[model samples]
Target: MRGVVMYKPGDVRVEERDDPRIIEPTDAIIRLSATCICGSDLWPYRGAEPVDHQVMGHEYVGVVTEVGSRVHTIKVGDFVVGSFFASDNTCEICRAGYQAYCVHRVLMGALGTQSELARIPLADGTLVATPGHPAPDLIPSLLAASDVLGTGWFAAVAAEAGPGKTVAVVGDGAVGLLGVLAARHLGAERIIAFSRHADRQALARYFGATDIVEERGPAGVDRIKDLTGGLGAHSVIEAVGTQEAMMQAIHATRPGGHVGYVGVSHDVALPGNELFMSGVHLHGGPAPVRRFLPELINLIWNRTIDPGKVFDLALPFDRAAEGYDAMDKRAATKVLLTL
Candidate 1:
């Protein structure tokens, strides 16, 4: 089988690799129908995170080809979507709706779904079969549900975005843009998206952003404050993992508001005194995507929301390197790799 591997920063290649097979009784094997590059993959590609012949990609949607003896709910021939993390889904933490932190969780990135075939551990707990084989047009959105869409939905829920709430999102990446959509679907009265790119700004508005703030750092916070009459937003979603973005999100929310941060933190530190005085609730880490997969799949299947619009560029599977380059250079918002 062929899979994507990053030999080093700026060096991605499509190479032949051993095909995956069931190694656990609870595992299931799937032949990928479609997969895509994620914003987080850029961390290793840019050297911000170490890489040495590392397998890439996590978001995927595909048809099951094999299932272990313990995999009863998901069977061969089923079309499924799964989270980046494979969890037992029956653990205490999972029962509490935090499957991302399940006691028996497996990080799927290590298994690498960028390949033509993948072994999904804890199959019954990790994979969600669609209502039926999805339409070709719905495949991209179903694939999005495997990760980005679910993560964004989790972010919106954590921020308690709903009717009468003023929501502000502090990033314009796919997840943040989808956060706008989630906020809208959840009934946020106003949604503000922070972005400098005109294309992203337009997409953000299309996703339900009522306003766009191009500024960053203190200026960005001031702009958010100005829009909210100096009180700041009722909820803020931090989708960029940076010291500046984190602080901007924290300070951009009003007292007693909520800040849901889903960005993978990279060298971020919060000021104790300032955070204590802010009197805001902070919640977010790796999103419990499994908790929202069923609802997300139904929405995507019904065509109620189109998160697949994030993939502005699509390339053949062997051209995976080009997809990485396009994303790293910001030439594409998201890249979908066709099988």
Candidate 2:
């Protein structure tokens, strides 16, 4: 088997590795059909995380190759979409719709998807079997449901974004684009997107953004307010974890508006006094994507939403380094790696 490994920043390679065998009675092995380069993976790609020689990738849609003794929900030859955070779906936290914080959780990157085959723990809890081996066209959408689509949905939910309310989106990345989609799906009447890039602005419009702000910092806030008739939007989704993006989402929100942020936070620090006066409710973090997997799968299966449209670039799994480089250089909005 071959898997992606990152030796350090600017270095992701495909290396031959031993195939995984059942290590737990609840585990299952998958042969990836499609995987992707996520923004979070860039943290280590850019040296923001102390990544040593480790596997890379948590988003995948694949066929189950084998199953452990206790795995009943998923079986060999079944196609499935699993969450980045593996969880026992029946856990108390999962039952409460917080699978990301399942008492027993495992981050899949420690065992990545950028491989010919990989082992997934808690198969019954983590993997969602599709009705059947889907048409090739559905692969991208299902892959998105694995992470960005789910994350965007979480951001909108956290921000209290809903029908008839004005919403502002703070980033233009894939997650941000999907956030725009989520807000629109949730019934936001007005969607304002902050995007200086024309291509992103176009996609944002396609995703249902009503306005695009090209400014940054205070100017961006003013622009958002200006578009909202001097009042900030009722709900703002922050998809970028930077301080500037966070502050922009906060400052551009109405006094009682909710701010939902799902960016992977780095050095972001919020000013207490500002937040105190802003009167905006803030919530969001790495999404419990597993919680939303079932509903999202339904939406996709029914073709209600096409989140896979976010993938602008596709490459062979062996060319993952090129995919990473393209994303790092801003040449690709999102990359799909074929296995």
The best candidate by TM-score is 1
lDDT of 1: 0.95
* Stretches > 4 Å off in candidate 1: none
Error of 2 at 91 (Å): 2.0
List where candidate 2 sits over 4 angstroms from the true fold: none
Residues 1-339 of candidate 2 have per-residue lDDT tens digits of 989999988899999999999999999999888899998888888888888888988998899989999998788999999988899989889999889988899899789888888899999999999988898999999999999999999999998888889988998999999999999999999898889899999999998999998998899999988888898989999998999989999999989899999999989989999999999999998899998898999999989989898999999988999999999888998999987
Model 1 weakest lDDT span, ten residues long: 142-151
User: lDDT tens string, model 1, 160-215?
Assistant: 99999999999899999999999999999999999999999999999999999999
For model 1 the TM-score comes to 0.99
Clashing pairs for model 2 are none
